[model samples]
Target chain A: MITLETIRTAHDRIRAHIHRTPILTNQTINELSGVHIFFKPENFQKIGAFKARGGLNAILQLSEQERYHGRTMGPVTTHSSGNHAQAVAFAARQVGIKAYIVMPRTAPQVKKDAVKGYGAEIIECEPTLEAREAGVREVIERTGAVLVHPFDDDRVIAGQATAAKELIEDADYDSFFDAILAPVGGGGLLSGTALSTHYLSPRTKVFAGEPEGAADAVLSFKSGKVEKAPYINSLADGLLTSLSERTLGYIREHVTDILTVSDAEISAAMRLVWERMKIVIEPSSAVPLAALFKNKAQFTGQKVGIILTGGNTDLGKLPF
Target chain B: MITLETIRTAHDRIRAHIHRTPILTNQTINELSGVHIFFKPENFQKIGAFKARGGLNAILQLSEQERYHGRTMGPVTTHSSGNHAQAVAFAARQVGIKAYIVMPRTAPQVKKDAVKGYGAEIIECEPTLEAREAGVREVIERTGAVLVHPFDDDRVIAGQATAAKELIEDADYDSFFDAILAPVGGGGLLSGTALSTHYLSPRTKVFAGEPEGAADAVLSFKSGKVEKAPYINSLADGLLTSLSERTLGYIREHVTDILTVSDAEISAAMRLVWERMKIVIEPSSAVPLAALFKNKAQFTGQKVGIILTGGNTDLGKLPF
Candidate 1:
């Protein structure tokens, strides 16, 4: 279980380095959905996603020797095709280190260029889990670099929790929310949010929203175990991670429900937010909103808070 | 000419009512353009545009007679097909008045829906300047509504000046910017920015960026006079106004240049911002960026500020 003290320490460490992203109130979405909607807009954060929180925390938590000796000359390895790769690269650059990102060859050029722009090296591989692991290992061995897992790590989970901590402190408004929805992937963010909300605002129910194409978290929550997703086909690249053991355990204890949204619903909700609220959010960010809209019976007239986890979609090639 | 004191008073009048939108830095654009780019992200402003500033200021400056005598119960009229229509509608709602928006029948459904969502009455007109004026007059006669000119009024210009005022106040980092670039329509925001910047930071140059297709301001600047737009042809709907006499006079005295960009450049800049910065901005917001990028030699290594005027694009049918 994560402690408030650890999360609070992480918050302090990354405070100056990361953006205290705004929690925007959407009157339009509220009127449209009939639920009081508060969006924790992480898109405004540095590196354009909430992944900055975790990466910054992990990098700052390293020992002096690790910071000086490991990062100075060699590279840091990460396997991601989304915001995490950019976050790690950004964090590494801030810490005076190079990053070696292992991405599939078919990854968006936008993401690839972003990683390169941060002075990071890239090693593109086949679009398979096995190839990704192999590419990461090769970079780790060749460069003698540190491996920063996107999620499935304690520090990363603690870092992701800080977003929730800020929300509870700044946006919870002293009113006990009926529910708080967070999208779950490898479960780092959701688990961290669950732990923080359970400890700080136990009266508010914590729910994990997932895409139907990436419903490992839902299955894991139902069976009281960790579930492995052999492959993910959702447009939401962020929520494709299977449940990590630590994250799953925390979710089992703290989260109230695990709901799923279809790809079509996510796309529709993404369009609704862009058309109505005028905010550019990726499909993954719309999962929680989609869940709220699809399961309106559960959240009717409820003070529901949602983490719009990311907005990193390339507008030129939006799925919509 | 507008004064700093008037702008400050406008700020105070709507201090709690409006959002002090965040300033976003674009690394991708900075790298590409070789100039440090700072975006005054009014895209995040209430009503999803900086028009909120002018609308709120205009309403707040209304005389007591306007507020009482049940005149406030009647609708407020504005001739606009863009952010101003929504801004006036939102401001009217805040002041407990109905808004009668006169928009072209060819206005985007998204903008129409925005006005409708604010509880405003929409009066559609033929897509012509003469037809629009006639439609607005008809609505005004029918409802006895107050006319909130989008950008031509003194109150609107004073209100729009606050964006530059806030930017100058928010960061006084000891380095004077070479110039401040903003799009010009009726020149409310551009002229107001020039006034405030001239008074506050005399050394900083203020430039009006307009689309080549709607270069009335450019022609006005060249001729040292106000000029009417030949016809509405730019994709940037918010930058399609004829230069007002007051605005043209102010720009003639204070603004250093009036630059123009092609429609393709505007669209490209819009796409770049949406992809790299992960912020949704309308075509009008990208005009200055387009101007800066298209004419890079003019701003090389110079600290530049661009007002990202709004984020009202419909994601379902983005022009790209």
Candidate 2:
């Protein structure tokens, strides 16, 4: 069972590798939303996302146990085409281990370059789930490398929980937040947030913001089971993945509610942060604030905490 | 005389109004540049620029003496088509006084709207310095409003000095930087930075960065008088203005050297900051870094301090 202690242990394991990203607030945002908002900006995190924490925690544990497929030292493998891939690559390099990333051939050249820049090997596969899985299996079969599941594993969930833990610990003067929000993709971040908020600030309500175009988490939250979205197209490319059994179980028990916003709202919120706060944040990072703006009456006068997920965006393809 | 004490007093005065902008350092940027760089990001300041400090300090003095142009409470005025207009407007509103901003009629509606959003009245003039001066004179004569010169005034210079004052005071572990750099436009920020570095970190060398297309300050520094650029067309719009006699005097006395960089260099440096630091800095803010990169031989391995001046940019028009 992943308890508060497990999250604490994970944070301790990855403390040196990850950035202690600052909690940022702008007064203009407060006045506009009729709520005080604290943003935990993981856009400044290593690998430019919160995935760094999970990736580091998992890889470091692999090194610590000396149980690397019964070898003295071994390589690790993961199948991701986004921040997760970069995170695994960056973390593997940190521990002097090799990382083999199985990425879709359809992925952007920039994404592939980022992984390669971190000194990781890339295995190209067709842009299909079956092909990706087969590619990962081939790497594991050939090299006896451990597969670091992106969000489905207990270690990854525990690592993601530390962001919320830090927010609750860093809240104003011993006062807990009234609510905490995180955007739900595969539910790793949201479940981790729920666990931390439930353990640390028990009174605080936990909410997940999901993209309406890729609204699987909301449907799954209602159905009490993992489900796929009816459609999967959104500018928030980071929040397009489906939930796993482990993450869904945590969400069913702990999360208060899940809200959905459109791509337009996400873009507006992203632009506002860029204009007012003078920081570069990805569209997925803006989903929580979009939800807050969409439902201001419920959160009036309340202090809300949001995890701004990442800042890796193609400069040439800006939304606004 | 604008001594270090004057700057210290200005900081204390505007401390409540402006943000004590944080100093940021990225290890990746350090490794890439081969210099330990500390960035004082005034892009996060009130009104999204360091102009807030000088504007507030100047206007706050008007409130302190109950001496508003020999009246109980009189309006304040300034003529600017840039951040200075917003700064004066914001500061006037802070003290519960009226502000009349004389701006070029051809100025962007967004800039005009920002001043209006802060509750300042706008007086539009033709796109000529003479017309701007005339508009300010008309407002002053009609309403007994005192003029707040953008950078040439002692009070404004003293206020601008506080950015470097904070940087020097916030340096790592009782030590100061080996060198400091600021971009020179009208020379408000550069002269002020030089003063602060000269007073607080006497061993530190002060340098100014100028856009090659609008290279006035460099000529002014060598000529020992205010000089105009041979031509003015650059992506660094904030730095197209020429220096004043007062600013030139300070630069000649305190600034060690003035280096110039092309528009291409400025754009490259700006993109790097946005990518690596995840901060939205305008083209002018990148000039100092561009200068550093252009002349890395002199600053290799030295701990360098840079003032990231502002973050106001037109989203529709990006250099990169």
The ten-residue window of minimal lDDT in model 2 chain A covers A64-73
Clashing pairs in 2: none
Residue-level lDDT tens digits of model 1 in B208-270: 779888889988888977777666698897887788888888888999988888899999998
Best by DockQ: 2
Q: Write the per-residue lDDT of candidate 1 for residues A226-313, one digit (tens) a residue.
A: 8765456897878888987888898998999988988999899988787656677888899999999998878989888788888888
Residue B39 in candidate 2, Cα distance off native in Å: 0.5
lDDT per prediction?
0.84, 0.92
Off by over 4 Å in 2: A67-71, A173-175, B67-71, B173-175
For every candidate, C-alpha RMSD to the true structure in Å: 3.1, 1.6
Top candidate when judged by lDDT against the true structure: 2
| Tens-place lDDT digits, model 2, residues B155-253 | 888899999999999996434698999999998888889998888888999999999999999898888878889999998989999999899989899
TM-scores of chain B alone in all candidate structures, in the order given: 0.93, 0.97
Please provide, for model 2 over A140-197, each residue's C-alpha lDDT reduced to its tens digit, 9 standing for 90 to 100.
9999889998899888888889999888888864446999999999988888899988
**TM-score of every prediction relative to native:** 0.90, 0.98
User: Model 1: DockQ against the native?
Assistant: 0.55
